[model samples]
Target: MSRTIRALAIVLGLTMLVAGCGSSSGDSASSSASSDGKFTVGFIYVGPKDDFGYNQAAYEASVAMEKAVPGVKVLQAENVPETAESEATMQNMIDKGAKVIFATSYGHYEFAKNMAEKNPGVTFVHQGGLKGDTKLDNLGTYFGTVYEPVYLAGIAAGSVTKSDKLGYVYAFPIPQTLANINAFTLGAQSVKPGIKVITIATGSWCDPSVQSQSVKTLLDQDVDVITQHQDCTKTIIEATEAAGAYSIGYHADASSLAPKGWVTGSEWNWTPLYTDIVKTVKDGTFKGSKYDGDFRVGLQTGDNPFVQSKYGSMVTDDTKALIEKAKKSFEDGGSPFAGPVEDQDGKVIYAKGKQPTYAEVETMKFFVKGVVGKIG
Candidate 1:
């Protein structure tokens, strides 16, 4: 039997070559390798494919792979967690004769790596994994530099917040979440010098109930604009729409969710990475190497996946032009965290006239100058 799950949140936005920033899908029926030479690939996602963001993006990539590469066999099961269930599901793929497996969640990292090692003949690619063990010779990992676009979304939020206060609904407090929050705060401060951002961590990635409450809480306090780093925009978009506030969305395009109040957002284009891996497998040149897809490969490049909706009439053409210029500048060696940074505790982290390096931005851990509340 096969099932579907949606994992991860997809941020949405426009196509500009900015410096920073950054599925599974499920299979319906079991199948064997293709009669032709193409190999069979299996994808495991942590959430439902219909979840409308992370899972959907990965599923879309698998579909695109099928369309682009004739005779390639692809199977998927959605909502498979990183717990014990992953071991069984991954084993099922191996037993079913999957030549390569793509585990598209952070939790699946160790599980997939272990299985890949146990089944040395099968190739595995785990997204967002950092593995130091040499036992996994068949495993590789890849992730995007998403902090770049999050900063850009912050710029939109910063420009649109009339109250100089912004709200964010976070899923977890890991390094990834912290980096995203920092990028957003920096973007807002680019336009409004001391914009205050309030953050609420719902702990779980796909809890609509809790996410909605967090957004509503912020709105009740008169937050004019909202942004989110959760897997779904159900809470952020719903609360913002109910309160008649603007929102910047993540993962996939959510402009339709808040048609009138939508601004730009951040996104990850999985197809470019997916296509490259599929091609590598086909060409027999694939190796177990870690890769970070970003502006260099046009993966997170143009306007196809990321788009800024012209929803708010208040969004000026000048603002759009400024965003374009900022993107260019960042790509041309400008850092998103360019100095005078402060945490939620009012202590200075990066001094004035100092800029963060790529490694520093990638490992970001603190709040910036204008975020209103603590990470918790």
Candidate 2:
């Protein structure tokens, strides 16, 4: 879930928080991370901020956090790599005056952990991970159950696919991506029995050239619907649209980008959670609060930062009803992985009447029966 950045710099967004997801962080006015009695919050993304995908969602929420929490200024660095450079960038933020750092990439957790130990004053929260090294209260991880909405989108994809071939272009077989793929396969199978999901794992998250080739590979296989788990998602979605294949979006609302092909999606709504976390930090209550450890949210938890996108015109009323009913099951303690689920080899993974817990699902390793891809 990371990619290379062409131009990397810590651009301080001191802009007054504006309305909508198209938030203009005031001006490109650069300043110290914190000045004029402002509490500074730092965020780093592995891709460009306006990529219409993952970074954009986080960027928008960062601006909202600044506005929602009083006396806060947001400092963001786009196209940050998952290398030692990430650590240095964070250290630079700390050197300036960042009190809270949102390491918003899976690859940044280790680096964030190291920095958390060194700078106990600055609280570090990693995205999509658990609290592994919890000796210090300064380091924690948090994420919404993103796979939940992906399953709903899969239902839409399954309903719309004429060829019964759904393609998935993913970055890597990380557990998070694996959970999304498996949930999507399971959701599709629930409605369209025998629907096959052809998968192409492009090792890079935002390599446009590789993504184009992967899209070509999936389309060549006669796939009628496409979805992905890459960092920068515009290329694959646009390519699929041009090829006349239905596209299920992820990470952000890209329905506008694929007007003809858009069929619902899973995207982050991090404003609520980001605001809550930043508020706690501003009040000096984050140390021993619920945000001090691994915090997971979903429909069952009253709110999930990841929610289903708007339904496309191709989605039928019956399919929307199915999605609503399926989502209700989750809210009622049912799961997308409620078994009898089978692995690729038809091995019974979860028995009937049983399902993996939220935490257990995070450690997912194998593809489900309908996924036409290898785990390694």
Question: For candidate 1, what is the TM-score?
Answer: 0.82
Q: After TM-score superposition, what is the CA distance of residue 343 in candidate 1 from its true location, in Å?
A: 2.2
Clashes of each: 33, 1
Candidate 1 residue lDDT tens string, 1-376: 1222222111212222221211232234256645556578888888777777877888888878767776677878887877877878887877777878888888998888778768988888887766544555567776665677777778888888889889888887877788888888888888887787888888888798888788889987778888888887776796787778988878867777777788777665677567777777766666643331211221223332333334356678777777777778766666666667777777988888887754466566777766765654
lDDT, candidates in the order shown: 0.72, 0.86
Q: Which ten contiguous residues of candidate 1 have the minimum total lDDT? A: 7-16
Residue pairs with backbone overlap in model 2? 15-26
Q: Which digits, one per residue and each the tens of the lDDT, describe model 2 over residues 1-376?
A: 1232322221223222223223322222236646577888889887668877777899898998888887888888876777777888888888778899998987888899899999999999888768854687888888998888999999999999999999999988988889999999988988988999999999887799999889999999999999999988889999999998899999888899899999999988899998888888878899888888888887887579999999889899999999999999899878899999999999999999999987899998999998999987
List candidate 1 segments past 4 Å from native.
1-29, 132-137, 288-313, 346-363
Task: Give lDDT: candidate 1, residue 217.
Answer: 90
